[model samples]
Target: MKNKIKLCILLLFSLSISAQKSNKPSTFERYLQTKELVNVQLIDSSIRADLKYATTDNFAKTILYDTLFNIYAHPVAAEKLAKAQKYLKELNPELSLLVYDAVRPLSVQKKMYKVVQNTKYAAYVANPSRTGLHNYGMAIDLTICDNKGQPLDMGTSFDFFGRAAGINKEAELVAEGILTKQQVKNRNLLRKVMTRAGFLTIRGEWWHFNAVSLSEAKRLYKIIE
Candidate 1:
């Protein structure tokens, strides 16, 4: 019947239009959608995320990312993070990893660098031109939280740009009574779990960890725009 054929054609055309609209993501949506990145929450919901850059609580005192954009990490890094979470549970079932920042865009990195450029904190933030592991989605800033979801004291808070936050200064601080023995113990525990899961820490930051060397990350991965 001609009427039946016309109805079927109209339905097909409508479905095709819907498909085209769905395929064309907005600029912001495309920015958040990357094949190389994985939503950490989707992989392991138990690992908590605060996402500092999404809020104005960061050192810059400005919101860097859209809050709707979920925390993301390179697939390799996400797997390692999942392993780290499992390791943390094995160490103490009540403890969990809390992510502060992960998979930062280069645009955000430049903003962070500008804020600390001329200050004493310049060394704490990496130069965007050099493109650090975080720019490549291979780094994470995180800390451990206890059963009650309270972050463990690491002698210094996240994004603390001082010698006290340096991993190498833990012993010195503990000796000077600036850092408690328990704080050092907590930092060590975090380091242990992350290292065992194939993440490496930098001497200058206790909260920062790289899933791969900076060179390796730059060579193998595309920097998230």
Candidate 2:
């Protein structure tokens, strides 16, 4: 009962913030506090973020998240992300894991699906009815970046909707000159740290890593609404 009251207060505060100045803290930041989510930086500061959905730079060509600036995740996922960051530092002290997206609300997922539902990219964006790993705060999309914060060339850019983005055909893509050997190496480096940290890589998206299986996620965590 007390928690419910606190949640209502936070929601009101978030709504108030949303109506205020653009430079002020956002509603999503306040809303995140209403949940059991953790800010990834609190677990590990070295992991950098370039949350695509927060900006208009995503495939949707729109700002999916109105004012979501920081990356947040379930505590379980956050710990593994921190472990990945530790492994990344050990592998290449000059490089760090740069996050592209993290825990997303189901409301945002619906908006994202609306943008791609009629296109070939629909499969890539999970239907909100079925829910997605990000909705469960168990999936991450990221890449490796240098000390200067320049992302390594992974052949296709982040959120590229094509065969080149698929992890299953690296050798074939390379042989066909669609992806270079160096690009594959850069991708492998990212996979190395994430896999070592217990994240599972899906075949269709090289940049995506799951903290656990969908079934396990359903059993353990509630989707963020």
Candidate 3:
């Protein structure tokens, strides 16, 4: 009877330590590992992730991810993310890459679609029927931040849909007095590191990037459902 009580006490102690260590719920990390995705922090602990969609602060104005907080991505994307962080650190050790979103699941994609569909934001949000690069863990939405983890002014906020958020006409936008040259410079710095890291930028969202082309993503991996 004493041995059983001692064993029970030991089990409780182990559980307490486990609870402290596994900050993320089991299902969360399981999904990440099941998809064969890498936690960004595991690659580069200094790489920060805000996961805007995890909260209600995003464009959708809903809690898309109530449980998920940590950032995860395909190995290819994760490696490139680390490279971007390294490059940024090389350029200015004070700066870090701040991730907004990564490895969006199909369920979350559907929710994102519902919020944007029939609105002007529709074109920007990927339709669930046709999975986005993020679903394959092959894309990232991030920005540059200071050592304090505060993001630089990249003109508009993340998930901002409109001419202000578009990178295609930054020069014209700057000339129009819509976006400042300093803002353009900041955006350019972000582009420099990410492009150097081999991520492709889209004409629409400056924060969004693809680790590989859509063709490569579709051919190489399955979407996270």
Candidate 4:
């Protein structure tokens, strides 16, 4: 009887430790496994890149981008992006900027920028896992056109977050009035096109869109590398 009681106590102790450990973040929590991704290249930049930033512990701020600076998105998110691009072209045939960053290759550096910073929130670090959506390769980040094919203003820079980064908030310095009321209309036009192609937008950030449908919620992944 004493041995059985001791065994029960030991089991409880083990379970308690596991629960505590689970609360702490680990690299494995932020990376996906090889079986969970689909590999493809959808970005049309100088270097096709795709990778997102996140930590194994928490997901307060997730930053997805191409392999280079000022790029974002993954290749798996291409369908909607293509739709948006086509619609944008229709709005302005002269717009000739190409898609740059999508999914990042693991060989590159991994770091998630704090899109929005506050005392309440902590930034996430990058963990390259074979299981991440970028591994499947379909997301993308886009820039606007300079005569030389550079990105233009939406509000904040590519991965910026804050009141100034608000999709609806107007910032003269960052956006250069690019996302004005008319610009929002133009953006909405692109949004409509993407929605038709199966993408959904979040209210807080104008640049963010998700391709997962309600039915595919289970498939929406949350793995650590």
Clashes of each: 0, 0, 0, 31
Report lDDT (Cα) of residue 161, candidate 3: 71
* Cα lDDT for residue 58, candidate 3: 83
Regarding TM-score, does 3 or 4 come out ahead? Answer: 3
List the global CA lDDT of all models. Answer: 0.84, 0.88, 0.88, 0.44
Colliding pairs, model 3: none
- Candidate 2 lowest-lDDT run of ten: 16-25
In model 4, the Cα lDDT at residue 30 comes to 23
lDDT by residue (tens digit), candidate 2, 112-178:
8899877887777877899878998889999999999999999998998889999999999999999
lDDT of 3 by residue, 63-152 (tens): 888667578899999999999989999999999999999999898899888987887777877668987899999999999999898899
CA deviation > 4 Å runs, candidate 4? 1-76, 96-101, 104-139, 168-179, 182-186, 213-217, 220-224
- Each prediction's RMSD over C-alphas, in Å, is 9.8, 7.8, 6.2, 15.0
Model 1: per-residue lDDT, tens digit, 76-159? 899999999999999899999999988888888898888877777787777888788887789999999988889998989998
**170, model 2: CA deviation in Å?**
0.8
Candidate 4 local lDDT, 143-224, one digit each (tens): 4454455445454454455654455444452366445655455355545656665676555545545666423532653322
Using Cα atoms with residue i matched to residue i, what is each candidate's TM-score against the true structure? 0.83, 0.86, 0.87, 0.46
Comparison by TM-score, 2 against 4, better one: 2
Candidate 2 wrongly placed segments (more than 4 Å): 1-25, 117-120
